[model samples]
Target: MTMKESERGDGGPGNGRPDTGADERPAEPAGLRGLAALLRPRVSRGQLAGGVLCLLLGFAVVAQVESTGRDTTFATARQDELVGILSDLGQRSERLRGDLRELEETRAELERDAEGETALEEARERAATYGLLAGTVPAEGPGIEMVVGDPGGGVKAINLLDALEELRDAGAEVVQVNNVRAGVDTYFLDGPGGILADGEPLTAPYRFLAIGDPHTMTTALNIPGGLVKTLQGAGASVLINPRAKVTVGAIRSP
Candidate 1:
């Protein structure tokens, strides 16, 4: 027997298994040491991927939150604006209601008066019963005359109409501008201040007469916010006189 053969048969230095067992030990990581060794290759890749995924998720959440907040802010601002507008409208409506109530009260008071018949009624009665001539009647009364001139002092017809409106509000029964009588269908044009009553040209200083109570007619001429003041401000001369007697040669109301 040789020395090598004797040592191998007795297996004096190692187990019967060969040194190949040492290679198999590294294939699987069991304990802490094994785990550390096994992690070396994959640790870097895992950390990088996880970090990126977290960042993406965080960004998405932040964007969603910002969008929701912006939408809410816009909605709130719109609501506030609408509320402010409604409040302003409500105030205006209340004021208009108060004015309407006052007008109703005034109208009711007027309706209760028995002697408030118009001058036309008296004329009609006199013509039918007393055989009085319509055109030969001499009239004396109170009234307002409105002179409308252009904003440039050019005397535009529209300004005259503005004055006519004031006269109507003042309760004039007979309004004549230049030589034209004012009627429901009376109008004015833009050219030199001239009145058009049923399409007839009438002339200036537009004299108006009222057959009603003298004091009452005067009120229309001099009342606050009346057409006289407005026309005067527009560079037009408005003269209102309380007449003792106004002669109308053949003036008749159609």
Candidate 2:
């Protein structure tokens, strides 16, 4: 039972094995095989075109169905009902426009009213200030009340005038001396029995009501060489009382 060399396998020496020669073809890659299979044209060009046409037709049909459904609501509505809805919308729009106009008018009126009220208040304040300054109206505020006692009857008109000037310089807003309102044209003269303040006779113990800052007026009079010192040097008694509220009710006649 001997086999010839040619009958033996290629490995020789009684070896038996499958041949792996260079003439055999190599196996294709899995990815390339799949690509080649896909390139083999499983679907004809006419069939692919037909499928695409079918998909497009389906989409067109769906869109048309949606459009028809949307139109069906208004189509089924009664003509009179549609007209009523439109009329209601128009009325609502007109009412909104009217409300806007009314709001604008109200805002404008409020602005005008505010401006007018502010102007009126300012005018009233100016009038009050002018009246107080002109000695046409009574004034009351924190001020000093002075009583000058002339025991020797030696206080002349000039001394009184100097005191008035000092008070005016110290920011006295309103001054009244024994029922006589001091004005811009006020004058004093020595009368028969007493000194005359603007032609009005004021005897001993002349009372002065000055409306202004009490502390300021008090300091101004008490300074050295001031009204208080001058009056005291003249042998006249000066009594200055700072009052929280002093009224100059004497008004100058027009």
Candidate 3:
């Protein structure tokens, strides 16, 4: 073969085939070689571990700095705005506390007023009952009727007063003599023509109406040595009648 054919039979530099040589071997990939160099154990195990810890500490310091920077943004905000927010919260809390206290006071006051009203009502009821018993008010119930006929005008004021005492002792709630109210403080005086009770003149044949239990009043008057016997000894005709219902429609002057 000629020299040109011999050169052609050998692969040219531009050909896809690799050059063969006894001193050359296949080259490793660049990325794989770099990875192998990094993984190669060149230091002690303790030294490697210390290097990784330092790297993690650096990353943590960087994160802390970023977080502190964000917090400083709020700290550098307007002083007036921060003060106003805190003041508003404090005032709202105080107002709520004041409202709660006022409600409690109102409830306590209402309870006290209710108790006072009940006590006042009870006192009024007691006053009314006493007024009725004292002959200051008109009364009506079963009682005894007495007719005293003093034909000789011999019924003295003392005798009338004694009879009133006897009737009161017999549970007489109210008494009327000749349509005149005989109260606890009533006075009887001897007049020229007849007897005067509470400044009102009374004629003869005095009619006494008392409000009480009829049986009790009758038994009290009919007892031996009672006011009836005394009045008969004074030459006054006395008659007592038990009535199922008797009314003393006279009220003492206020």
- TM-score of every model versus the real structure: 0.37, 0.66, 0.53
- Candidate 2 or 3, higher lDDT? 2
* Tens digits of per-residue lDDT for model 2, 1-254: 45775565458543766566789888798999999988996788999999999999999999999989988886888999899989999999999999999999999999999999999999999999888877888888989999998898778999999888888888898899888999888889987777898788987788888988888998999998888888888889999999999988899876
Q: What TM-score does candidate 3 get on C-alpha atoms?
A: 0.53
- How well is each residue in 88-198 modelled by candidate 3, as lDDT tens digits? 999999999999999999999999999999999999988878877676777788998999999988788888998888889999888999978988788899988678998
Off by over 4 Å in 2: 1-87
Clashing pairs in 2: none
lDDT of 1 by residue, 73-153 (tens): 646677778788789999999999999999999888787553456556777877743321222233444433333333355
Give the residue spans of candidate 3 off by over 4 A: 1-117
Pairing residues by index, what is the TM-score of model 1?
Answer: 0.37
Q: Model 1 clash pairs?
A: 178-203, 178-204, 178-206, 179-203
Q: Worst 10-residue stretch by lDDT in candidate 3?
A: 8-17
Preferred candidate (TM-score higher): 1 or 3: 3
